[model samples]
Target chain A: MRVVVPFAAETPKTRLESVLTPAERSAFARAMLADVLRAVVEAGHEPTVVSTAPLDLAGLELPGEVAASASVTADDRPLTEAVNARLPGGDAETTTDEPAPVAVVMADLALATPDALERLLTSTADVAVAPGRGSGTNALVVRHPEFRVDYHGTSYLDHRETAREIGATLETVDSFRLATDVDEPADLVEVIVHGRESNRAPACLREFGFALDERDGRVDIVRNEDCAAE
Target chain B: MRVVVPFAAETPKTRLESVLTPAERSAFARAMLADVLRAVVEAGHEPTVVSTAPLDLAGLELPGEVAASASVTADDRPLTEAVNARLPGGDAETTTDEPAPVAVVMADLALATPDALERLLTSTADVAVAPGRGSGTNALVVRHPEFRVDYHGTSYLDHRETAREIGATLETVDSFRLATDVDEPADLVEVIVHGRESNRAPACLREFGFALDERDGRVDIVRNEDCAAE
Candidate 1:
């Protein structure tokens, strides 16, 4: 099976701008992408980073054994179209009689682990999906050639319906790490709180001098005074 | 209209026991109940505390003019049955020619504001429901006598079905304060973060030595040494 990590390389993580500068957002996005790539590599899958803009993969610390590739989408299309183009029956040039299943993983899943990716990729169903909170399709393994993705309003529900229409056996994987995508300021709190053990994203957040603190009677991200002075 | 606050006073806030002792849970539960009651009173409504055990309203600091009552269920019935009994066509006996609408509000809405409650009570639908973050019905306004309450699994969906069965128009009120209910340890983070601006629940949590802190890469409630000594 082939894995594709869809990344919004250009103007990424707009929601996180409230807490992070543009440079910090770009660096954080790359750190999260690296974290996801490391997990995919650890799961014994060679992942291709499908980016919006040309990405410099030389700086990324991927697993030594795993051969990772980077490709830029021809156009600035919706995530669904960009990811769909890389699938078996998609527009990408390929010469295999039987196209292998393609798994599309979101780049923002900073908490995802190798075990979680292995579980998603190993599902026997024609189409396996990991649903995110608030009706989102976080990651999907599309084994069926005819199955396409639609990331518009409540895409998880839409994907389920599409799978049924194509007579594909749909399997839903409930994973906490895969379900979490860093989108809002509230989400940063989760990354800071849970990503401490992980080296990539949590380390990046700490290096950026961000810490969770209760300010004005609410939980918010506060800059460490010691780090700020440095 | 009369407002009814359903409280699980016996084992209130079992989820918070990880951070709070049994005594602290009881105190926190009472503080949240008081906050909800204060909102109901400010909304120009008299609220009754429908609890598992008989409650002492004299201890609660309610508004001066708002007269609050307390009632205990004969048995540990499901929340549906308990709240249903307080409705117009419900088990509660009525002598007037027309039965006034009754609003059922959950006791754990720590951030509930007066304006939010007023919006719910003033809704013109035969049955109005405030949907919680998960599958919970935080509050409901039943103006139609035929309308009933169902607090089963995913009760908000069940309530909508029940309203349709009764041919009553259902209005869904979306209020951040009304939508938030303290259920899990993670929920306490929201309370500590958002409730700081509010005096009632935030003050009570702070007074109990509870504060948000990151431990082992997760946001958790921790006690201050000075406050613990107190």
Candidate 2:
């Protein structure tokens, strides 16, 4: 089955861009994108990044040869609407006479693993959603390409409902890594803690030298600049 | 008493600079410095920022007034050594008489407040360290300038003990705001949360509204990038 990774940049909510050096935001986005692409390739499927800020990729290079695409809407819409609008259009091109399944992943999953994707494909359910300790779903995969669903607020519950509406089996799996997405800085702590175990940790993370404590969660590591410059 | 804010860039055992955009690091430093200066000025004290980074304050303008000074160090020594080395040296013009008490604050304190600084000065103790929930010491004020002290490593407790050994009265105060410092991204959450109430808050944080629930300790608000961008 082909995998489609959907991603978008939310427009600035404030004038934070004016304060940040251009180098900082670019570095942040590049590092995050690298890990998502790596997860896709490690799963033995090609990945595509659909970004609103497509030009942000000019300087940095990503690993594993994943393709890049831009969202059609110049006017930013809700994440679910934009991502869902992109999926159905591509579904027909990838499907054969007997259509195969597709995995729709949120590109921000910091701890996504290849093994998890493999399991997602082989699972008995028509729809699978990975839920963390927090309420929202991080990822969802459908066994039937015809399974129509829009991932948005409370996606975990939405996916389960979508499975019932489509008369397809719903499955839940225990995946600590796949359940977490980088929505807030707090979410970043989890990745810094356990990212080494992931199949494709972006070079940025490795460069950051993320240190994990199995017990205490993510601890802050003093950076190289802290040592070399000051 | 004149406030001395010594900013140290601590080097961790691991380096994570590659993941962070240069802009992010610079923005983080600039933002912190702005807030710290604002806090100092609001408390009705002369603000001197003793930075390890090169101080070229030609273009940088802050609210109220701030003085920028650089510590002369050839290499990266321990954090304590670097800060102490920059203390107003005893030149011919510099009198031998005792200088007024100074509040040595961390540059990265997320919850730093003018009220906390005033409270710290009210006590007659030789030294006061603000301790948070965990082992982290957020801010420290020394009323007695004659006593020599150094802060480095996880040995904040040992630093306090050494202060006592030198016949200096050491005290610890519980401060919710002064206890949080931003060394990692996760720490940024607290700044974004509690900073809403601070007079030193940046234009960005004020633009992005925050609902701080003191009971549950959750900040509910729509995240915005405009503040940072501006």
Candidate 3:
């Protein structure tokens, strides 16, 4: 199976702007993307980074083993369109004698592990979905060529409906790593606290001097001024 | 309107047993209960504690102002039944020439504030619900006599159906404080981090030496053994 990691490279993690500068946000976004790509590549998939713009793969510093085989494609369309276009029958390059399955993994899943991705890829169902916090479709493994994605409001529910309409056996994968995507300020706390064992994201957070601190009765990310000033 | 705080005093916060002893859990549960009660009383309502067993009011150490008017009652029924029985028409004592409205508040909302409770109490709808994280009905205000509660799975959804069935106007009160209920071991992080501005819960968590720490690539609550050892 081929894995597609859709990344909004141009204006990624807009919600984190309150804490991170635009450059910092981009760096953090790339770090999370690299972590996700590492997991997908470790799961024995030829992962493709579907970017909104041309990504500087050299600057990303992905693992050498995975980086060697990884590919990048520029797709300015909306996420659903980009993902649908990348699926087997939609793209000329992906069409084969027998259609291979495709998995659309989100770029912000900093906690995703190789085991989690392998479980999703190996599922027998025509459609396998991992639901994120709230109503998001975090990751999807689509075996059916006609099953297009809708990343609109409550898209997980919509995916289930879409799967049923196309007569695809839908499998739901409830994974803690997949469910927790770094979105809001509160989510960054999750990354700082839960990502110690991870390579890329935790190192990025530490480099930025991001630490969890309580302020005004809320768990917030605080940066050491001296370290950040450097 | 009368406010009922239904506390599962018998086996309260069984989920916290991984981190807290049974006595510690009970103390923590009572601390959260006091916080909710304090908010209810500050909202200018007579609050009652509906316990699974007869509560020792003197031992609870509630705020003096709230404790003066607060009452306690024993009811071993399920949460739905206990809350429904406390509503206007369900209880004979609560039935009057002009029925007063009822608000059922959960005891585990460590972040609840007086202003939050006041907003819920003053809502014009016949049934006002405050939805918690996941599928919980955090708090509910019932102005219509026929409006009862069902604290089953996805209870906020069930409450909406219950309101519709009874021909009551349903209002959803979206309060962050009301939504954050301390349940799992992870939830204690929320309480320790966000309850700083609050009174009882924060103090209790601190007294118990609860602090957020990272271990094994997961965010977890760690207690200072020296402080807890005391």
Candidate 4:
């Protein structure tokens, strides 16, 4: 089973700009990507990283097998267009094989485990999607030849419509790990709270000197000052 | 869109017998059944209640439209066998149809609303399921010709296996309202806590003189003696 993990190389996760600097955001995005990739690889499948631009994987802390086998492809198209092009018959420029099942696991699903990925991959449907908390689609496995994706304005709803229109069966996977993606500054706390269950995202945040603070009944992630760059 | 709302008519919800007497438990079960039937009617589908024994809906206090439209069927077989018998080919004694979509929404999903039911009905999959929190399936819409249900241990997992074996596409609806069912004593607190959203289950509980007590950081449902057994 081939699985693709999409990572935005340029200005990734801009919502975290309030708390993370440009360099910090990039590092954190890579960390999240590594976390997602490890889950996919451990689920018994090699993963391909689809990035908006070139990614430097050197010294990028990943499991040995993952670092050795993972591949990257640079593409500048928008998410919807790029992903649709990956689906068979969506684009003659990219898709060059017979129609078959292609799985897309987004890089921002920092909390996903091998079990969650396994569930999504095993669906015997034309299209199987995991919904994002905010009505976006976090991941999908598309087997229908006519189904392509549209990522604007609640892509989860759009995918449903697309599947129905093409006479393809659609399935949704109810999963917390796949649904919780690191998008906003507030979402960082989830990584810390749910991190103790062997999640790598929390360790990534801690490596950058971030700590969880609970004061006045409010939980927040605060960065340590002593670890500032020299 | 014929929807079946299954109710166990005899000695129902024995798990709550500790908190509620036999009569009170029957009333509460009827209340929950009414709640589910109302949602189905509001979703623009007429529902049939497949009960284990005869159901007397005389004083069932349902909305006018639901009371006028909902119908019930008596079947003494186990849940899985009874439901399959209703399915097209599962039994020669029952179904005589050429296979079409049939939806089964358990009467215990007290939190379900028209919107949640509509989501399950709108799925384009061969089998669309809304899972229960404890590895059970609360509701499902089956369109596959060869698919049927098994209500034994972990029916959610069983249904998935059944679908895979029959090569039928499966979809899971990730809905909080559909996922929460009022089966255990603690589940009553959910209807009370989230009840303000026009849930009939909480109202049913209130009519039976039950209230939530959070005296010690631990929340519980305690029956009020003043309004009980008058």
Candidate 5:
């Protein structure tokens, strides 16, 4: 299977601005992309990173196949547009040369593992989706040629309706790791709390001196006192 | 909101028999129950554990209200039938004194956090469901007077159609914490990998000398040789 990870490198994760600076956010975004790419390759699939800007993947340890191949495509278009154009039945897609199956995964799924990615990529459903915490499509596999994603409001629901309209079967992949995308400041807490042993997203953030303070029944992301402020 | 957690204490988690003895499975189930109960109480709600048999919660440290109140109800019946009998629209339920809103949560949600429970219980939607990994309803809140549960095959889909049939609003609490339920040996890896720092399910399993050997990209639950076999 071929997977396309849509990453917004420029001004990415704006919701995390309160906890992470612009530079930190960009670096964190790259780290998350690395995690997603590794998971895709480890799940036995080829991945191409569709970024809003040219990604500086320096110092980030990614899968060799992804880094060496022309896997990272820089497109400054919106997430939905860039992703749809790469789909099998989208604009300029030739019927004879179209890819039979393709998957679109968000770059911010910090908790995703190879097992979770395997479930999504190998699902026999016409449209397999891993929905976000809200009405967002975090990761999805498109076997049906007519099913294209829309990143607008309530996109998860829209994807279901669109699949139905196109007479495609929709299977919801209820995976915790794939469903939880790190988009907000509070989401950082989730990654720290539930991240796997070797998950690099949290390791990268921790290297940036990030910590979560859970006290008095409230959770907050804080900087480590030992590490001096930048 | 009043929340009911359906627990099968007699022969719990039969799918895990290959990995755990019956006694260990029951103890692990109770540990998971304790986690869910604490999450519900900390989320600021009342919970009652509806068990198939009287639970032996001797070693498990549960929430004060859950441990103190006459909250544990023993009903030896099928899970679907037992739960439907408690709903407001079920038989012998008073139309005048019906609890306007009620929530049903599975006791095996080892990853459920207080924040996840708060999202399900505090939803203004007429019906809120936290679907499990498959077509199972892991947790749900019911506000519609005519709505009832059916734990048959594809219960999650059944609940959605039931809500629509009764002219009630349905909202999916797309929560990862509430979705991952500890069931099989393979699921043990999930608990150990993604379990919170204070989550007791993995801790309880660890106490049983359970360990995951993730060698050569394959995850296997094993016993620590240092610890004597049970």
Candidate 6:
């Protein structure tokens, strides 16, 4: 099946801004989007990235087809509506005749690893939703494009409910790398707490004059006691 | 070589009075000490406990050999002094005359697990220090009894230095479950963070009234959050 990556293209939305600083938000979005595009391209498939924003993401080194949204500011619409409008969808549950499946991902997840994404896309389950520990969906894969996402109060929970409404089977898997998203300052703290020592984002935060006092595998907002010399 | 467990027989100094109410301190201390003993027993190595404080911990449900300390507080002295003072130290370092390697562990590691402890003891290294992430020594195994342990400031670092001084090779391994000791309130958070789901001290803390705002697999002492509500 044709792989579809429907992402809202705006300069940067406030919902995204509320979670990460401007630099972090831009880096997070661009990096994750590039990562997903790389994974799809490496699998010998062309990914159709449907974005509602301008084509300003040109400079990013992505290895897939880029499609800009026909709308002005695509950030205000709900997540599923934005995605379904781009892929082949109708009033009824959107189903596709493609032999394989389409993988849908939100562009804001910094925790999605290539291995985990590959596993998620290659999974044979009828329906899959990558639910964040908090109340949100990070990614989803459906064998048929006929499935419509219910992106309402708590999109993660709503997507699962939508699967049930459509008589689709759902399964939860333990994926430490893919189960997190950078949403709020605390979420960034969570990322850094579990982040790899070589990860660039946390180091970028540190280099950008943000002090993160980390100890015992927990990250606290920069505090004076931790800032003296280290 | 014989395995030696050094414990302070006197109840842990009441450092909790500043943070915990009298009732809370009493309960916390009792639970902490009890778990320490239980963990040592659960780890399957019945220790020859050399108590620095004048009290009896041998009655707990574990195989143990107890000896009372000649001093009130054994501070800053090399642990080698404390341990060797109990065992026959003369010619103890010789591989031919002395027994095999001995494991020296503090009795205050309340979160130690039998599986992890077995892993440490079964390791073939001449000397091994189970490394906790931050600066602290939880447990170590020395093949030579004559190998002196000057556990000085930040003994985790000092332990490595002492190992080098004794001409012993040092190995670092990650099994925090077997190496965490309850020394400070922050250390107690480590116990609560990685302690087994069935551990009683943290459970008792929650039962009495201590809130652990767990985030990203670590516990934080946040007050307004409900512990038992989960």
Best by TM-score: 5
Weakest 10 consecutive residues of candidate 1 chain B by summed lDDT: B66-75
Query: Over 4 Å off in model 1, which ranges?
Result: A66-75, A214-219, A225-230, B1-230
Estimate, for each residue in B1-230, the C-alpha lDDT of model 2 and write its tens digit. 55556654333211214323454455455667667767766677666656555454433456425543222223245456654543433121144666556566676664576776666656678777764322445566665544544553333455577677778788765444565566544444455544635434334344443222222322223333443332
Error of 1 at A193 (Å): 2.4
Per model, kept true contacts as a fraction are: 0.00, 0.00, 0.00, 0.05, 0.13, 0.00
User: For this target, which candidate reaches the highest DockQ against the unseen true structure?
Assistant: 5
Can you give the TM-score per candidate against the true fold? 0.52, 0.42, 0.53, 0.53, 0.54, 0.47
How high is the CA lDDT of each candidate model?
A: 0.76, 0.53, 0.79, 0.78, 0.77, 0.54
**What's the distance in Å from true for residue A193, model 4?**
21
TM-score of chain A of 4: 0.91
Give the clash total for candidate 4.
Answer: 1
Over the stretch A1-230, how does candidate 1's per-residue lDDT look in tens digits?
Answer: 67888988889999887777788888889889888887787888777888877777766665565434443343467788888887778887385678789999999988788877887999989999987654568899998889999886556767989999989999876555676789877777657654527547888888878876654324567786566422
What is candidate 3's lDDT per residue for B28-102, written digit by digit as tens?
Answer: 999888888888888788888999998988887877898997999999888888888878788634456677788
Which of the numbered candidates is closest to the native, going by highest lDDT? 3
Report the Cα lDDT for candidate 5: 0.77
lDDT of 5 by residue, A1-230 (tens): 87888878778888887777788887788878787787787777877888788876545666567566427769988888898987878763546764678889998988788888887887899999987744468899998877888887557767989999999999877667788788777678767655666777788778878776645424466787565335
**CA shift of A124, model 6, Å:** 19
Off by over 4 Å in 5: A56-59, A63-66, A92-95, A225-229, B1-177, B180-230
lDDT of model 5 at position B39: 78
User: Which parts of model 2 have CA positions greater than 4 angstroms off?
Assistant: A1-230, B8-20, B66-77, B86-93, B132-134, B196-230
Q: What is the lDDT of residue B63 in candidate 1?
A: 50
Over the stretch A1-230, how does candidate 6's per-residue lDDT look in tens digits? Answer: 45566565555434546434565556655665665555455554556666666545466644334323111123345566766654444332255543355566665555455555666676777777665543345677776545666554355556667777878776543343455555455555534443445445555455544554545433345523332223
